[model samples]
Each structure stands twice: as structure tokens, then as C-alpha cells.
Target chain A: MSHTVRDKAKLLARVRRMKGQMEAVERSLEAEAPCGDVLQLLASIRGALAGLTGEVIEGHLHEHVVHAENDAERDKAAAELADVLRTYIR
Target chain B: MSHTVRDKAKLLARVRRMKGQMEAVERSLEAEAPCGDVLQLLASIRGALAGLTGEVIEGHLHEHVVHAENDAERDKAAAELADVLRTYIR
Candidate 1:
């Protein structure tokens, strides 16, 4: 789904930062930086990505599933959405 | 991703029942059923639908976001995922 420009902008900013960090991480690997520091960076990146995924899913639910007019359709839609969430939560 | 046959079957069953209920609801409206009864049915359908949506979102996160290999990509994905969950939780 298409997001608002502001939303897209914010996400892009985060992505850019992540890109820079990752590039630096690549350099660290080449330079044989401390394993602990590399692991820490990996963890930080993982957390940030998880947060971004949450945003997209939430926006989709609000715009599509919440306003569904057909009760049966809504049920189906919700189930499909929930199926995704169950995995995320797990 | 395609679901297993069992998952699809179960989802179909729920969908079918929801369809039947919605049809019955329409009939009730035509017959002027009690407002309270109609409202109660509406509530049940809404809950079921919400549950479904949660599932789909969760599934997508696990399949796509969780297994990201690139640190930059993972961070971006996670942030998006979290953005979605925040709304779901709310």
C-alpha cells in the first residue's frame, strides 16, 4: 500500500542510516574488527528492521481491514491479516 | 507464500461460516430483527475479522522480515514491521 509522503520520508531516512552503518560494518569485517562489536551492530540493525515492518503492517490494517464494509469479506481479510501477525508475534 | 492445505481448508471453513452469518444478518435486517440481536452478531463478526487480520500480518513478518540476511535490510524491515505492530497493539 502507498504511504503518506511524510511516512515514506521518515522510513527512507532510517533506511539511509542503516545503509551507512552496514557499509561501515563491512569495513569492520575487512579490517578484522572485534567480533563482539560486529555482533552488536547486527543486533541493532535487526531491531530497526523489525520496527519498520510493524509500521507497514499497521498502516495496511487501518486502511483496508478496519473499514471493510462486507462482514464476510471483513472476516476473511482479518483472518489473512492475523495469519501474518501470528507469525510475527511468535 | 502459499499456505498448507490444512491451513487453507480451515480458513475456508471460517470464511464460509462468516458468509452464512452475514447472509443471515441481511435477512434479519429485512425481517426487522431486534436491534440488540443484530448488534451482537455484528460484534462477533468484527472480532473474528480482527483476529484474522492479525494472523496475516504476523505471517508476513516472519517469512520476509525475520530472515533478512543483510544488516541494513534487516534493520529497515524490522522498523517497518514494528510500525505495523504498534497500530495492531493499540
Candidate 2:
């Protein structure tokens, strides 16, 4: 549980770093801004959103499934695992 | 890329199988199985979960990020990359 929380924090930090950016989009593509100038920027935003969702799902699966004490717990864990897979598939 | 899409499909299939296993685990738990057995199953499930996560992250990085075509693509790739990281961190 505690670990999950810490992990979440770490994820956020990572996001912050990414935001920094992607190094300003690689300095605007080496100043060669073209090709929709940032079609990628939009993509980036989408990615961020997906990332957040993934994190949440991951945390939930790990914490709940792992914490399980009995067979049910095991099952839960399995489900969590599946969930992670789902994310990948998506 | 096409490969990515195909990979996604494979991952999804794996998840489906895992989901079934999870269902079985639930049944076992309901059967009042021993805590030890259930615990073992839990561990396995956790492993599977981790494995799936790792694979997805690896694929995304190697394919999308590395293959990015332009600065925008790079940014998007970065964001997507961040997204995956967030999940891992969590």
C-alpha cells in the first residue's frame, strides 16, 4: 500500500520530467518546424492522458491483487495481471 | 507500425488467457483452498503482471520512440513513453 503510493509519486515526477519535455520537442525539431508543426504535440497530450490512466490501473491491480491473502487474492492478482496486459494491448 | 498493432493483438490474447486463469483462481479460492496454495498462485499472478508490463514498455520504446519520424513524432513518442513509465513507476 505504502509502496504503491510512493510509486505513484515517482510516476508523477517522471511525467514532470517528460513534460520538460520532451526537451521542448527537441528544440522544435531542430528549428525545422514543419509537418504540421507539432502534430506530435497533440499526440504527446494524448500520451500523457493514457499514461495517467495506465498508472491508476496498474496501482489498483498491484495493490489489490497482491494484497490478497487467500485464493481469492490470487485470483485478484491474476486479474490485475490481465489488466496490465490490457493496457499493453490498448 | 503494423508490428505494433500485431503485438498489441498478441498481448490482448495473452491477457484473455490470464483472465481465464484468474477466474479459475477465484474458483479455487472459493473452494476454500489452502492459504499457501493461494499465496503461490498470487505470486505467479504478480509475475505475470510484471512480465506483461515490461514487454509493452520495451516494445513501445523500441518501435515508436526510436522510429519517430519528426520532432512532433518524437514528442508524442516521448509522451507515450512517459505514459508507460508512469504505469511502471506506479
Which candidate leads the pack in DockQ?
1
> TM-score of every model?
0.43, 0.45
DockQ of each: 0.07, 0.03
lDDT of 2 by residue, A1-90 (tens): 333344534544544544453344344434534323233442453355355445645555555566655778768667656645654554
Candidate 1, residue A57: how far the Cα is off, in Å: 1.6
Instruction: Please give the lDDT score at residue B73 for candidate 2.
Output: 75
Q: Candidates' interface RMSDs, in order?
A: 11.4, 13.9
Task: State the displacement of the C-alpha of residue A67, model 1, in Å, after optimal TM-score superposition.
Answer: 3.4
Isolated chain A TM-score, each model = 0.70, 0.42
Best by TM-score: 2
Candidate 2: DockQ? 0.03
Where is model 2 more than 4 Å wrong at Cα?
Answer: A1-90
Per-residue accuracy of model 1 over B48-73 as CA lDDT, tens digit each: 76665555555444444443445465
Per-chain TM-score, chain A, candidate 1 = 0.70
